[model samples]
Target: MYFIPNENLDPTLNLAMEQYILSGLNLDEEILFFFIDRPSIIVGRHQNTIDEINLDYVKAQDIQVVRRLSGGGSVYHDLGNLCFSFILPFPNQPVPDFSSFTEPVIRALRTMGVPAEKSGRNDILVEGAKISGNAYYHNKFGTVCHGTLLFNTDLTVLARALNPKPEKLSAKGVQSVRSRVTNLNGYLPGIKTTVEFRERLLSEIARDAKTIELSDADLANAEGIADERYRNPLWTFGTSPKYTLKRTRRFPIGEIELRIEVRDNIIRDVVFFGDFFTSQEIDPIVDALRGSELETGALTAALRSIDWKAWFPTIQEEDFAAFVAQGD
Candidate 1:
């Protein structure tokens, strides 16, 4: 096994570097690497970034958002959080097991007296509180398993950043569950800084491991990939599969449920169902929203252009705009 050092703190660059290394995999060698990124939220390859985040909060806080190569739930990372990756040749095990990939981490934590154990499907818990979450990706050449380890992360920001669906929250049986997570710093009184925690963890995992250096060409390729793909908004926020966006709001007038089928960043269809009273037919308003850009300004202008008071006298144009663009 070889230990590769990551020098960049950009989430996009780090994810690009992981892919770059994974693509250059040799069947005989495995590589281990870890990095700390600035405040960011990384969504799984199969997840909808918009659906996983509070867009208003993310934008206001200016947090970096990116899509990762592995499929798993969204995770928040900051300088206090450490992310580790292992790119290894295909395992001989017939049925892939997460434990095989996570046991090393568990061992490392246990050695530090953290009492870490593999819990549920793909998480490491410290005294029944989660400290790590893992995700995996497999290709013809090898398997890449990577995850986040919370050392001294800002739990408050993490809680507000991820906007999981009701079903997912209920399934996990923990609503507003950031409190269920614990940081290694709390357990390791000896460690003064996150940097210390990272070095110690790496030391435990990479005992007498060979250090490998990436050539300039390798780095440039990774940077180029980051700029062209990982950093692009299309991959981060716009590549979600076709999905229905449902938003329900209780206006002073009545309750309204807005259902929209969005495709390729366009509103393909829209329906408004509610107990709200209207004098004129709402078909025109629905048609106006159809084929329109899923943008607040455009939707607002469209609504303002029509005599919408005949349909919804109690609501304001800005409210309609906010409702459609809120992405709730």
Candidate 2:
């Protein structure tokens, strides 16, 4: 195994760098790397962002939100969190054998006197509380198994940032996010800081691995990818599968209900219903959204072209656009 050194805190650049190393590099051997990000929320590839996160809380806190290349529940990260990734050849069957990838970390933690064990499909638990969550991404090159370790994360902010559905929480028999997770700071024997814990864990995982450094060209290419894909709102919010969104809000004029159908990130159909009074036909407003993307910029442009108050005399274009594009 080869180890790469990374110290960047930008989540988008970190994710793009992972993709660059996995798909851009021609590798015959396995590679391992670790990264830490500023306070951010990383969502799964297949999850609807509107359902997985508290949009208002995240925006107010100035937390960066980005989607990963793997499928799993959303997770919150900060400087106290440590993330690791392994890029290796695909197994013969390519089944989701999470134990094979997680056992190493569990063993390494055991060496530090932390009783960590694999609990469910893709979680590492310590004393029955989750400490790490893992996910996998497969491509033509190989498989990328990445996961987050909660060393000393802020449990309060984590709970406030993630808004898991009530059904999901009830299904797990847990009332809140903080009740299901724990930090490793109190469990470590002598690790004083997260950086020290990272070094120790890396040494334990790959004692004899060769160290590799990325060149300037690799950094530029990864930054380009970060700006083009990870930083783009379309890929982060509009990449989910087809789904219908029904939102009802009350304005000073009256109540308005919007039912929007989206497929492949484009608005397929829109319908308006409620007790609101409109002097003009609503077809023009509905027609404007038929082909627009479900993003802030796109929806704003589409709605700005029309006179919103002409339909609902008290509503403004910007407010209506935000209501249509907001994630609950």
Best by TM-score: 2
TM-score of each: 0.72, 0.73
Candidate 2 ranges with C-alpha deviation above 4 Å: 89-96, 239-328
- What overall lDDT, based on C-alpha atoms, would model 1 receive against the true structure? 0.79
Q: Write down the lDDT that model 2 would get.
A: 0.82
lDDT of 2 by residue, 1-328 (tens): 9898998999999999999988777766788989999999998764567777899999999999998777667899999899999877543335346787899999999988999999756789999899999887776667788999999999999999999766556645788898989999999858877789889999999988899898999999999999999999997787443349977665544346677898888889876644333434578998888899888788878987888666655676767777888844
Best by lDDT: 2
Give the per-residue lDDT digits (tens) of candidate 1, residues 1-328.
Answer: 8888776899999998888887764536778889999999998764557777988999899999998767667899999899999887654423246788799999998999889999876889988788998887765556778889999999999989888666555555677758678788888999987778878988999878788888898899999999998999997776433338987765554446677898886889876544333334467998878877888888888888888886667788877887897854
lDDT of 1 at 63: 94
